[model samples]
Target: MTATIVVPTLGRPSLGRLLEALGPGLAKHRFELLIVDDRPGDRPPLALPPGIEATVLDGPARGPAAARNTGWRAARHEWIAFLDDDVLPDPDWADRLADDLAEAGEHVGGVQGVLRVPLPADRRPTDWERVTAGLADGAWITADMAYRRAALARCGGFDERLPRAFREDAELAFRVRREGWSLRRGRRRVTHPVRPEGRWVSVRTQRGNADDALLRHLYGPRWRQRLEIPPGRRHRHVAITAALVTAGAAALVAASGRRGWTAVAAGAGLAWAAGTAEFAAARIAPGPRDPSEVATMVATSAVIPPVATVHWLRGWLRRRAAEPLGSQPAGLPPAHRCPAGWAALSRPTASRSVPTRPFASRSAEGSR
Candidate 1:
């Protein structure tokens, strides 16, 4: 199978590591490499081994989703293998990818490569490390997934509006499976190293709350259940934020000698503190008990709920204003219904009907 390897880079230092690991594969295979520079400006100068054919293109910098879309659209081969700049491919990646694609049938539209995150075994992982390790269990992440070019065309690639790497992959996969195509897990495995990040990385990730609104706008509120992800405590976070805010306001009113407000404040304050303490304990228990670590956790725990709540609310309100419920985004294909036998997905009524033009046909037209 002729394949093009597409990688999206944000000018990461790890890009060099990934390229060095793929040197052998590049030497042995006639694969084309499409390196999309998501950073704004002129084309980037990426060095590679002799005799390798590679092209670099500028990405919209909307996000990784958009970058991958640019990379795959510019690809020439029938199969597109997407690798993130930070991932390390196995030495036999070429052979394994060939083997994975060789076995795909007409019904198989994509093959997801295995992702292995190597965590330090000596000590209990930090909250950030544990969160990063979740990628190992994450399905269909482009970190090492390969797609049939036709499948990508059918799915209209990915939703470029999802301006983050989070949930965008799942959103695309959710759409693809609706087209009556199956995505199989492939044998190829890549190592996704956990690079050091700031203590507040977890807090910053709440930004995906806005992206979640897009997913709900496209799929509906039951989207998580559709994807089989466990129900998150976002509502509880909102409740916690509300309780804390209400408590503070009531405490101020009570200071004005309002006895009724004093009672309300006391109850709200207890609930808020309880919620915060529970959150802090969960994070603190698994983390290294250093002073900075403890302080960071304490500070972030108080802040995350309100911040996450605000982002979620902003995303929800933004969607409600921009599009009504049950309406699909303009220029985008409607979500495809899962084929019968997917008992779990059978309930999303919106996805039950196929779009007017076949997803592949519409996608091809869109590309032109």
Candidate 2:
């Protein structure tokens, strides 16, 4: 069974490094590589190896979901393997993937590979990068995931509505499982090195909260809880910020002869400080860098929760408005049982006879 490796790139120069790492594996597996350029202006920097077919597709700057859909659709192979432009595959990745697919019968719908990111030794990560880095080794079912072409066609690929590169994979995985297909972990793995990120990485990543809200809309409130995933702290932060703002405004009003407003403002400040301290302490590591970074993290953390909450709430509201009022929810119920005779039946057993009652009962009744 031939496999096509589909890579969606955003014009990162580091993609050349990813390609170089795949050199040995690609040659051994002889899988076709399809690179979808999400950035229209830039082309892939590296040359394709001999006998390895490569294609580039151009279109408007839609996100990775669209690019992946386009690339997977273009592929002629039965299996389509997706790799992030930033990831470096292990040497036996291809062979292991082939073996994995072989072991996974037709019922298996998708395969996810492990992702590892190595951090730098000298510098402490910014609050935002740390949050993003939390995802590095996180059962990342996105990068290095493979799916059957038929499964993609059935589920209609990733939702184009997911504008960013976040939660799109979860949405797809959820849908595939909902359709009675299974997603298994693959033996193959990839190392995702942490690229140098800007100071605003955390701030920029807040947009993910909005996408997450979309996921909640698509799935339900219980999605995170049931999946054993924690809700992003953004909502809690937002709530605290709202309280602080309200109190501060009330205090200013009270200072102008309104005693109630002043009390409210004072309460608000105390609450904010307490909340900040708690959040900082939880995230703080045990080192000299801990206190400073924790402070920065706390200061920035307050901002994120509210911004994320508002954006998520906006997406949720918009989705609710657009959806038809009484549309049926997606997927089958969790506890659906097979029909009676459909299940394999056990051999019929002989009935055990009950012991006879004593005759003394009738004689006693007659005497009464």
Candidate 3:
């Protein structure tokens, strides 16, 4: 069985490593490789290895969701397998992938490969390590997932409105299953190494709260239960933000000599402090708790609540009029015409080639 491997990339340095590791696995299978470059501006041309042949396509720089849609729709095979730019596929990945597809029943629409993240052995993991490790348990992460070409064509690829990598895969999985397709786990494995991050990595992740808000808007509050997602600390974040806001407002009122405002401000401040402390303790307890790690945890614990709350509200407001998954027509965005060079580029070549042709229309109704 042949499959198409689609990888969406921001042109990270790890792209070369992934390609190098992935090449050997494909030796035993008939697979096409498509790399969707999501970078907005011009850069150096991608350095292709000598033996591996890959087609390079331009992404709209919207996000991975848009890039992935650009990919599977352009594929020539029955199954489209997605791998992140950073993941290292096992040497037998393609063999296992073929077996996985061969065993899939007609009703099965998708297969998920196992993702193993490597952590530090000697020291306790940092907060970021723990967060990256969570991908191992994540549902339909697209870190290493394969979907039937027919299933993608039927369910509309992915919601481009989700501007981040977070939740888009699960959201699409929901739509796929809602369309009467079952998803199962596969034996193929990929190693996801924890990449280095800035000190504010945890803070940056709170932006996903906006997507969470979008999910809530699309699926209602019970979306988490339906998606089999565990209840998160969003409720606590909301309470903490409320307490902090109330404390500041009450303090200002107390300065104006309002009766009992000082007590109210004191009470609100105490609530915020207690909530922040508990959150920090929970995070710090499992981590290495080095001075820098503890400081990051404490500082971010204080900042995360208000940031998460604000993003959640922003998403809630932004998608207030959005329809749920199946309420509208869904499928890969339609194309007007293929670029002139597509036919020639689609053919396999002995030498390296990059196809710089636009495939799909940017304007599609209800794709969000």
Candidate 4:
């Protein structure tokens, strides 16, 4: 079976590095490369090496899920391998993938590869980078996943409603398992460099809570709690709000000539300071040079919980009515349209067993 490597990019020329890293493997396997550019009016530099056929597919700037679907649809191969823009694949990655697919047999619908990261030594990592680093070295099915074209077609690709990169891949894998297909892990590994991110990365990632709500709507409530996915610091939000309210009441009482106001303010200040300091200390390294960064981290800590809580609450409320989950997009080609009168896809039951864990790492060509 022919293989196609689909890379979804946001017009970052840095993505060329990912393609370059895969050159040896792609050339050896004679695999085609498809680059889907989601940016409008911007084209990625097309200076690809010989034997790698690159095509740029344009689609609405919905998100990575949409971009991946667009690229996979444009591919001509029976199997589609997905790589993130920030990953560097090993030289033998392609051959290992082919062998893994062959070993999986016909019922195997997908294969996930291992991801490794080498962190920088000089700089203390920001909280966001720390979270990202934790994701590396784990069995992740989303970043380096491969799927059969027919299986993807059967389940209607990724749910485009997932507006961000987080958890969308897991959601797709969950659906694939529900369909009674197996997803095995490959022995090949990819290196994911820790890119520099702004300090607000953790704060902004609170959007993931909203996405989690969407996943719950699609997969039911047990998935999150069972998977031990922490519901984004909602308890911290309640604590912050309580402290603020108590401080406000204390101020009003003091203005009315009451002695209790001092106690209230002291209590609130102590609670807020302790909470912030604890969060900052947990994330920051202790050193003379890190004091300023530590202070900034502490100051920002209080704001994160409330923002995360509000976003989660909003998502939960918006989806409380149990609206139809996956409706076919309008104006799709006749072949891409969902079957008429087909009942809406329901949440797959947790009792359903996944034939093979999608994220397990195995040997390539029977070699470690």
- Alpha-carbon RMSD to native, per candidate: 8.9, 21.1, 7.7, 9.9
Q: Distance from true position, residue 231, model 4, in Å?
A: 6.7
Q: lDDT for each of the candidates?
A: 0.75, 0.65, 0.83, 0.66
Question: Per-residue CA lDDT of candidate 2, range 1-368, in tens?
Answer: 56888888775766666777776776677777777666755433333333334665553457888778777766667678999888888878888888877777667778888777665567766555565566654542568898876566555677777778877777777766665667888788788777776644666777777777766775677877543355667656776777777777887798789656777787888887777666666655532366656666666656655666677777777666343112123542221222223111211111222122221221211100
Top candidate on TM-score is 3
Task: Return the TM-score for each candidate structure.
Answer: 0.84, 0.79, 0.89, 0.77
Best by lDDT: 3
- In candidate 4 the C-alpha lDDT for residue 308 amounts to 70
- Give the Cα error of residue 175 in candidate 2, in Å: 0.3
TM-score, predicted candidate 4 vs. hidden true structure: 0.77
**Which candidate order results from sorting by TM-score in descending order?**
3, 1, 2, 4
- Residue pairs in collision within model 4: none
Error of 1 at 366 (Å): 36
User: Residue 216 of model 3: what lDDT?
Assistant: 88
Candidate 1 residue 113 C-alpha distance from true site, Å: 0.8
Model 1 per-residue lDDT tens digits across residues 312-342: 8888787765532222334433223322233
Writing each residue's lDDT as its tens digit, candidate 4 over 214-256 gives 6677567576653335454556666875776677778788889
